[model samples]
Each structure stands twice: as structure tokens, then as C-alpha cells.
Target: MYTPKDFVESRLPVLHDAIRANAFGTLVTAGEGGIEATHVPFVLARDEGPMGTLYAHVARGNDHVARHAGEVLSMFTGPHAYISPNGYPGKATHHREVPTWNYIAVHAYGTAETFTDPDRLLDLLSRLTEQSEHDTGQAQPWKLSDAPADYVAPMLRGIVGIRIPIARIEGKWKLGQNRPAADREGSARLLEQCPGDNEQAIAEAMRSV
Candidate 1:
């Protein structure tokens, strides 16, 4: 991300929230054949540094995982909305005003190691399920231990767990900060009434800006 100083989100907590809220990320890597990418849900761990670790898994048959093991990029996408110049109060004064996109995103660069251990893979799956299901109400949640060993054993071979040690992380927030206050207010007002979730998100982001 070509993040300008004004738009940079350097706070580790904010960056971590971005990753957690948007757990799904695109993994990119290169190998002898060429570049490959895969979309996967990631589990982010925040320990030291403003940066954090990324844990995810792919199908055993996915060749992309092998190439991405040593190094990879995990991207997280936050709320994004379209901002029309019409929403700007200064549109009349600034005839050159144009529509723009308001959004936030984070890119994580890291080195990954794949785990072939069956027990580890099971543990990873448990953690992933718990994290993802936290918000959803499931009176009786599902668990690997609840499943029979015979069925679970075959399932384990189908996936591979990969751990990525964080090398770098970048976050960008573009919420019409460059626009005049009047324009910002106007755009935010229009967004609040918009029906889509994305538009509502923009409305909230503008308030923060």
C-alpha cells in the first residue's frame, strides 16, 4: 500500500483489529512455475512489535501453499464505500471535485512454515473455529474431539497448517480527510442513509475522521 502519512494507521491495536475483523486474506507467493495466490481465513496473534503473526491453512492439494511457505503476503480489507462529488458541500465551489473511494486496508508480509503434524493441525482447526464462531450463538459448539477418531483422521490429511512470522505490516485509512469539513459532513450524511452495509461503514468511518 502506498500509504500517505495522513492516512497511515500505525497503532498496533488498530492494525490488529483490522486484521481480526477481516480475517480472510489473499495469500501471494512465487515459485519456479510462477506466482500463485489463494484466499484463506487467517488467525492473527498479537504479541510484540506493532506487527503480529498470521496462521492459516490450505488444502493439502493446494500447490500454492508450498511456494508461499517461506514468504507470503496476507491482505485484510475493511469497510469501503464510494464517495460521490455530489455528496460534497463544496462541489459547487470546487468544480474539479471528483468521486473517490473511502476505505481501510492492511497488508501483512511474513515468512511461513507449514506443519504436517496431525495433532497440531487439529489444534489449529480448534482455534480457528473458536475465533470465527465467537460472535455467532451456538449453544452447543462443535469440536474435533467430539467427532470419532476414524472420521477426524481422514479429514486431517486434507489440509495443511501454515504459520507466518510477521516481517512487516502496513495499514491505510482513506476517509476523505483531504476534503473540506463541509464536504466531509455532506458525504457522511449521505452515507448514513445509504442502504448497504458498506455505505453505513463509511458513514461511521467519516465520523472517526
Candidate 2:
């Protein structure tokens, strides 16, 4: 991530927030042939290290996991939108600005390792399900144990568990931090007025940031 000083998110808390908001991350690893990537929902454990621990899994038969054990990069992408020059007040001055993308993304580079332990896999699945529905106060929360043992056992065999010990974390908040104040304000207004949920959220981000 070639981030300029103006767009770097050095604050650990801010970086964590971005990762949490976008838990589904891209897992990248280098292999004997080349690089491979898989999209997976990750659990980030903050207490585990200075950065954190990342948990995710893939299908057991996944051939991509076999060739790599080196460093892995997990990318978390947040609200992203395009800022149009039309939003700028400087349009009246004919400043002629190019459109740019505003977004928040967190990249975690870590050591990749696999977990084949049945107990660990069960625990990880339970944790993942809970995290998925943590906001809902479901008295009978869904669990891996809910399924029949026979079914659960077979299902577990189909997946491979992984833990990535985070070595470095980088965050990028390209929310017009490098742009002029007037242009940024105009972009916010323009994006907010546009259609769709993603763009609206992006607009709100520009204003708040």
C-alpha cells in the first residue's frame, strides 16, 4: 500500500475500526508457482498481539492453501465512492478537476499457519457464527453444536482452518485528505445526492471526516 502521509491511518484504534467494519478480507499468499488469493471472513483478536490475530478458513480440498506458509496479506475495504469535479465550487472558476475515489481500507500482513485440530476447528466455527450474529440477542443463539454430531463431523472435514499472526497493519483513508477543503465539501454534497447506499455512506464519510 503506497500511502502518502496525508492519507495514512496510523492510529491503531482507527485501523481496527476499519477492519472490524469490513471483516471479510482478501487473503493473499505467495506460492511456488505464483500468488493466490481467497476471500474469507476473518476474526481479528486484539488481545493476541500488538496488532492482532486473524482467523479464517477455506474448503479443505482447496489446493491454493497447500503451496504457501510464508507471509499473508489480508485486505479490508470499507465505504468507497467517487468524487466528481462537478461537486466543487471551483467549477465556477473553471478549475477543471479530475474525479477521484475516496475510500478506507486496512491491510494486515502476517504469518500464515493452518489448524488441523478438530477441537480448534470446532471452536473457531462457533466463534465465527457468534460473531456473525453478535448484535442480535438471540436467547438460542446458533452454534456449531446445534447440528447433529454426524452431520457436523462431516461438515468440519470439508473445511480447513487458518490463523494468521499479524506482523504489520496498514490503513488507508483516502477521504479527500489530500484535496482542497472546497473540493472535498463539494464532493460530499454531490455524492450524498447521488443514488445507492454505498455512495450515500461514502458521502457521509467525506462530510464527517
Candidate 3:
């Protein structure tokens, strides 16, 4: 993650919050054939391990199921926005600032294992669904039980559950912490004026820092 000292975030709770907020992550592994990556949503068990445990599922036919062994990396990306030098308060005077990006990202490293237990897989699916539905602010969140057992059974059989107890974790919050306060504030203001959700989020994060 090539994080500078100013951007490094080592707090456990902070890292956990980032993972939970951005649960859909890229899982990377190296095998005899080559490196493989899979994008999946992960459920974090914060108290399960020293760092945390991640639960996810992949299709039974996914090559990741067979190739994922030993060390694995899961990357979670949070809000990000491009910062234009024009937003810097001192740009007019010094003309030294260049464009850059502000973002939050977390990397988790662990050993991955796969399971076929129907009950465990079902539980994983339910938790993922519940979290996603809650995020949508639905009046009634969907549950696994909403579907027929027979129909779900076949679906469950088509996938494999993955468990990874985090051994190492790193977080980087590049919210212009290294920049001058006036410049940071100026950039944040510009970010808020941008049209995307991510830009707004980055602006908020910059304010907090």
C-alpha cells in the first residue's frame, strides 16, 4: 500500500469500520498457474480473531475456490476523489501544487480456507443480505427464509463458503493530511461541489481529518 507516515492509519477500530463500510472487496491469491482475483462482498467478524475474520462465498466452479491457499489479500476501497491543483489556495501564488487523489483504502492479509457446509453458507448469505438491505433503508429487510428452503438448497450447493482470519491489516487515509490547512479546506470545498457520492464522501473525510 506504499503509505506515507502522514497517511498511515493503524487503529483497529478505524480499519474495521472501513472494511464494514466497503465490504465488497477484491480477493487476491497466487497459485501454480498464476495470480487470480475475485470480487466479492465480505462479512466481518470483528471479535473472531486478533484482527478480524472475513466470510464470503464464491461459485463452486470459481477457480479461486481451488487456487486460494496460504496467504491471501482482500482490498477494500472507500470514498475517493481527484483533487485539482486549481483548488489549492496557494496555487495562484506558488504554482507548485500538482493534481492528486484523496482516498481511503484498507488491505487485509490472511490464510483462506473454503467450506461446503450448507448451514454455514446459509448463515453467511443471510448476514450479507441483512447488511445490504439495512444499507438500502428498506422498511422490511429481506432474509434468507423469505425464499423456499428447497429452492435455496440448490443455490447453496452451487457455491463454496470462504473464511479468512485476518493476520495483518493496513489502512491508508489519503485525505490531504500532508497539505496545508488552507489548501486542504479549499480542495474539500471543491470536492463537495463535485457531482458524485464519492466526492462528497471524500470532502467529509477531509473535514474530519
Q: Pick the candidate with the highest lDDT.
A: 3
**Worst ten-residue run, lDDT, model 3?**
61-70
- TM values, all candidates: 0.92, 0.92, 0.97
Q: Candidate 2 lDDT (Cα, whole model)?
A: 0.84
| Runs off by more than 4 Å, candidate 2 | 135-141
- Native-to-model Cα distance after best TM-score fit, residue 195 in candidate 2, in Å: 2.8
lDDT of 1 by residue, 9-126 (tens): 8787888998998898898887777788899999887884447788899899986777544667888999999998888866777677888899999998988788879998888888
Candidate 2 per-residue C-alpha lDDT over 1-209 given as tens digits, one digit per residue, 9 for 90 to 100: 99998888888888887787788889988878798899998887877888889999899888576678678889999988877878889877877777788888999998888877888888898888888767467887787677898888877888889988789998888888777887788888888788877789887777776
Supply the global lDDT for candidate 3: 0.93
**Residues 143-206, model 3: lDDT tens digits:** 8899999999999999999999999999999999999899889999998888999999999999
CA lDDT, every model vs. true structure: 0.85, 0.84, 0.93
Clashing pairs in 3: none
RMSD of model 2 against the true structure: 1.8
Report per-prediction Cα RMSD to one decimal: 1.8, 1.8, 0.9
Q: How well does candidate 2 match the true structure in TM-score terms? A: 0.92
Q: Model 3 off-target regions past 4 Å? A: none
Q: What value does the lDDT take at residue 100 in candidate 1?
A: 89
Task: Tell me how far the alpha carbon of residue 5 in candidate 3 is from the true structure, in angstroms, after superposition.
Answer: 0.4
**What is the Å distance of residue 10 in model 1 from its true position?**
1.1
